[model samples]
Target chain A: MIRAERVTMKFGRVAAVNGVSFEVAPGESVALWGSNGAGKTTLVRCLLGILRARGRIEVGGCDARRRGKALRSLVGYVPQELAFHDDTRLGSAMSFFAGIRRVPVSRARELLDQVELDGHERKRVRDLSGGMKQRLALAVALLADPPLIVLDEPTSNLDAAGRAAVMKSLVALKQRGKTILFASHRPDEVASLADRVLVLKRGRLIEDTRPSLLWPSEAGVLTLRLFVDAERESDAAGVLRGAGHLVNLNGHGLCVAVPGDRKAEPIEVLHRSDIRVRDFQVLADYQPDWSRS
Target chain B: MSSGAVQTAVPLPRPCSAARNVISFARREVRDAVSSRWFVLCTGAFAVLAVGVSFMSLAGSGSSGFAGFGRTTAGLLNMIMLIVPLMALAAGAGSIAGERERGTLLYLLAQPVSRLELLLGKYLGLGIALTGSLCIGFGLSAGVLAAKAGGADAAAMLMLVAFTCLLAWVMLSVGMVVSVVSRKVAVATGVGLFVWLALVFVSDLGLMAGAIVFKLRVQELFIVAMLNPLQAFKMGVIVQMNASLDVLGPAGMYASQTYGRTLPWMLVGVLLAWGVLSLAAAGVLFQRKKSI
Candidate 1:
């Protein structure tokens, strides 16, 4: 259902997504694996016609640029970031999206149910937890019952439970014959849902093979640094350590091991300690330097 | 699978499909606008000034007839001119930029809707919301005037309300363009205030300065007034309310003398051109824009 030939995205002197090409047949699930700046999001944006690029991309047998409306209408999309109005209630959002997609409101409710958001229609979107929001976004993607669904880092900010909920929904979508295409850095999500894996590095496709061929040989580790006040840094580190997270002090800030897919945990720990975190970033493929030595 | 021929999208109702998408998005904007305290405050400001001035005019004029309505509308028009444009700017400045920052724009764009439809619908929604609030404010006061002085009394009031809505629309369109270009709501709002200042203070001051420096005649001043929607709105109101045309300097005298009874219609055309062109430009620009 998807074909891309030599897709390249350039911004002035920098090429964000260089020449890359791949395809996904109808009912096939393909996961794009990449590091943070691997052009995964840019590639997905190109497929969705959000960005202009030099390439031939045909989704649902229509050129992405020429028939963007038809191409978009045929694909369900969940962006990497949380995408919903804070003040809007879930039911109203579903209805609004239904009107935009020209679908029935009942279908929205059904999709919400499929994503395990059955009884939370009246809740304001902002009131939902991280995982619930991810699930809600999934339901929105499934609203039109499109033949294909494209997700960009579907569970990038979610906790383990949220990630599980999104994975469950994807599995169910796969069983129902919907072609799935996603870009993600999480090996676990790839192992769970992707039939094929395409690895990207520096905007180039490095490997195009089955997920098993890539092998989960190296267990991924997450390294995070939280910038806090000197007075609160020791206290914040203790909170994370109390929660079973390994903590180390570096020149820049307190570095912590955020186990598994729970990236928000360290921030929550710091919040409980009344430490204001100024900034933070995640390194997904990190092999803790302590272990390296 | 021979299912390559399967149609993934159901045949949507064409022709009015763009309109439908616009309306759908518009309704959301209107809903959000009305729910916010900002819109409520705007409507309140309009109502308080309109109703309070109506009563004040009646008391001050001591003539509960056409003259009383004239004084009331004259007072209210200045307030509407100040309030409505600011409200429209506030409404529109955050409309697109805020949504883009929130990532909601991407989700909305990923659907079947076209960029033009989305932009138009958002502007329409915001325009309608601001217009509706003005209507409520004007209607409440106008209703009182109509009841006390009779049907003929409120006619001018309704006309003023219509012109004010048009002015609001013009500002909303300008604000939409700002929102489209800005990456964050903070920047959009800053740009919006700057625009309001340019229209309200800079343009009016510039016109007067030009009139003095260039020693512009009545006709030249009239053309300059037509160039600014806010100036057009004020002149249009002053002419309709039978307030002294001399207050507008030579421009008003030239408009009344040259345009005859069609000056109101000409002002309407100016407002429409301002509203339609900016709105259309915003839609076209967004179509070619990188939404991400």
Candidate 2:
């Protein structure tokens, strides 16, 4: 359980997180929803006591700032970036974390199994794919079996399969009664895992409600701009069109309409046709136009 | 739930003791440093330089065999003074700033470890690693000398090695302070090199300029030398070997007359002060560091 009252953190004249207040009951799964620079990560850092902020923050009833060690002991954190040393072996990392967290290596091994990373202990961190590294981070977080799990955009960088694997593990963790708090901008991710969504905008909490009430799971659409080589633009457009996606050449790139949860599909389709997308950006969000289709 | 009641209700994992956390982190640092390419290169350089100096000293003297520990150590002084500080500075400068660059500092701080424990453990581990390398380098040279030159003054050699280790600690402490304040590893390394240049080269030049321009007295020069850790180390070795500072000219003679048999201990104290003061400052700066 966590309680925050008017928490605010400032960098120079700008407040990264401002006067946000919330609470989570034990065993509850909550999501902090926001766009980039929307204070979600800052708020999470404040809660974790990594950043010093003004206001009262209590994790399991103790002030987080006053009792950081205990707060960390109660919360297992998975950062958005996988920053393990490339030369480090999984087994060595596990053992080192175990030693610091004062847990037996057996507990770390069990965690590895829980995260489905067993039998790859000898593999170096660099050899693991994006998803495997993320999962290993998760296992490291669970080294001491902390009561709460806090994740910062857990699947934001993963491919479809990688996202699915991490999502499956998270769903299982929720079922096992671990209090969950995560920061994400993906509607479907919040819908799938969050019981309550706390929407943040520009350093302030704008909305706090049920995820279903905030966004219908299947109704959202995202417009994306995919940039490819100039010579291959037509080929990329043809491949997307062949996949039944409505595509338009916008001079700069091809604009494709995608369902919110199926955004990875267009990129995957392009990859399958050997059309490499140099870059992509979400242009806008709106409901799909049925008449145009 | 109220704070007291919740704490009583849930059983949390007990955090590692401060000493245990420091030791564990230190052991990992040692392993990392020992396996690093820089450590290997540094050890090899020391060995080669030691052997070269030992052989060169005897050859330069037109002697028949390799020099013993006393002669070899005296000849190797300048090389140790140049190499040890640079290696220690590079190692310490990279420690925290490199972790920050790689984004692992945030992850490390997320665990139940204190900043003091991490910093102290890092210092201890690096100190051990540097000490180990120095011993191996000197040991190899000593082995050759013992076989060819018959017997040697092991005590004199040990003293030099000990002083060199202390010098490494002093520079390492200074480098850690730089690492703590720097935002990037590259910046820390640049600043460390600048400091090394200042201490090793510029300081002596400045002292010479001051002696000429201000007509500094021998006693004043001796005071200044005591303040400069490098000069103090050199002077300490000379006093240990010759039992008098006559070879160091007027300032050395002044120091010998003033401190007498206690000069070596005084110089040792100066090195200790440099290490301790720099380390203490680093600890304070590290504790106050807010950003990862």
Candidate 3:
């Protein structure tokens, strides 16, 4: 869906993206993984033809340098920063984009419903929480029904639930055969949504592999806190251990380490074991070793 | 769900026509401008100030009867000069910088629309909004004058409205140039206010200084006055009302004598040229911008 050859973007004397080359096939999901200032966003901007670079880029068979408008129309983009006119209601904003993308205004309802924002159409953008705004951006991106979706750190600022909701929506998009090129620093997010991971460091593409192979240690693993009856704490830990999860004892609960996408597996295991759970929460998520290095 | 669900569910959307995109952008800009609290306050303040000034002019003249439209418009000229340019500057200063700050500028640019289309839409939209506001403010003042002050001339009022709208458009073009050059909204607004101050007051003071120090000829003074759109507008209104420039002293008299009956039209043409040239420069500057 995207082919970038030796793409080098420079700001002054410093190169932001240095001779990076990669290609995404149809229906493939690729993640640009890196730390801040590692040039993921810069590279994505170059691919989207927002920024002109040294090398050649072709998105959906259109040259990024030559045909910006045509290339952009083929890709739906969700930016890392969410900004809309605060006074604009959700419905009005949708209708405005619908007109820009040349879609029927009525299509807004279905897109909103798909993003799980059906009834909040009348709410002004200022009234929405951080998560709702992200979803709304996603809906706007889909207005043209573009084949490729480019998201730059789609869920970075979101809370746990917000992140989960965006991830779920993305997963649904993937299942519907949308080719996605997203930039993110979260390892668990990379594991869950990305089929192929492109690791970037100081503007260079250092590695390209599957998400499973990138995590050789517990570095990016998440800690989930499961609260139960005080008497059943030990039982919950034992149930998690038997289910092949690494369990640790914490005050008032048991801590289980799991990848972000599988946080529910331990709970499902406990439910099947007839252990009633009281409450649960994510305790912490660690940055992977690649980022730390 | 099947992998082909999205493709099967929705057909591809058609490419938006350039004209439709520009119109959509303009409609949004107008709606935003008209609904803003700043627009409302400016309109109300202008009306109240105009009416108050008209009443004060009559009272100060020791006349119980209403002043004629020509005199009323002359009284309102300074007020319009001070308020309309400021209002237009404030509105236009936010054109590009405000969108960049809100991050919507880049988002919109990433769509199928070109920068020229967006900029043109914004300029046209803001022009309509400003013109609409000026008409309403002047209409309210005229209505009050006709009813409370006995009567006013419809043709004279219409002439004043047309000239004021032209001045607004010229200042608005300058403000858009400020917006395109400045990176932040605050900076653009500050520069806009500074430009307003320069054109309205500082330029006149500077001209006075030049006249005294250099012993400038009346023709030289008239030429300098023609360069400032604000001065051109003020002179245009005065000449239109009185059909002469006797009150403007030597320079105005020189211009009136030199241009004859075409002086007012020449001033109008100067104002129109300022509006068109400044807007064109802004478009070129905006096109050269490398970042959002």
Docking class of 2: acceptable
- Residues B152-265 of candidate 3 have per-residue lDDT tens digits of 767767888899999999999999999998889999999999999999999999999999999999999999989999899989988877656877789998998899889988
Q: What DockQ do you compute for every candidate structure?
A: 0.21, 0.31, 0.32
The candidates, ranked best first by TM-score, are 2, 3, 1
Winner of 1 and 2 under TM-score: 2
Spell out the clash pairs found in candidate 3.
none
- Per-residue CA lDDT of candidate 2, range B13-67, in tens? 7778889999998898888889889899999998899878977765566443323
| Shift in Å, residue A169, candidate 2 | 1.4
| Candidate maximizing DockQ | 3
lDDT per residue (tens digit) for residues A136-217 in model 3:
8888888889889999988877877888788877888898888999998676778788899998989999999997776534
Tens-place lDDT per residue, model 1, B101-183, is 88888888878877888888888888888989989988888776766666335557767877888899899999998888889
Candidate 1 ranges beyond 4 A from true positions? A216-293, B1-16, B144-152, B242-246
**On a 0 to 100 scale, what is the lDDT of residue B132 in model 1?**
91
* Candidate rank order under lDDT: 3, 2, 1
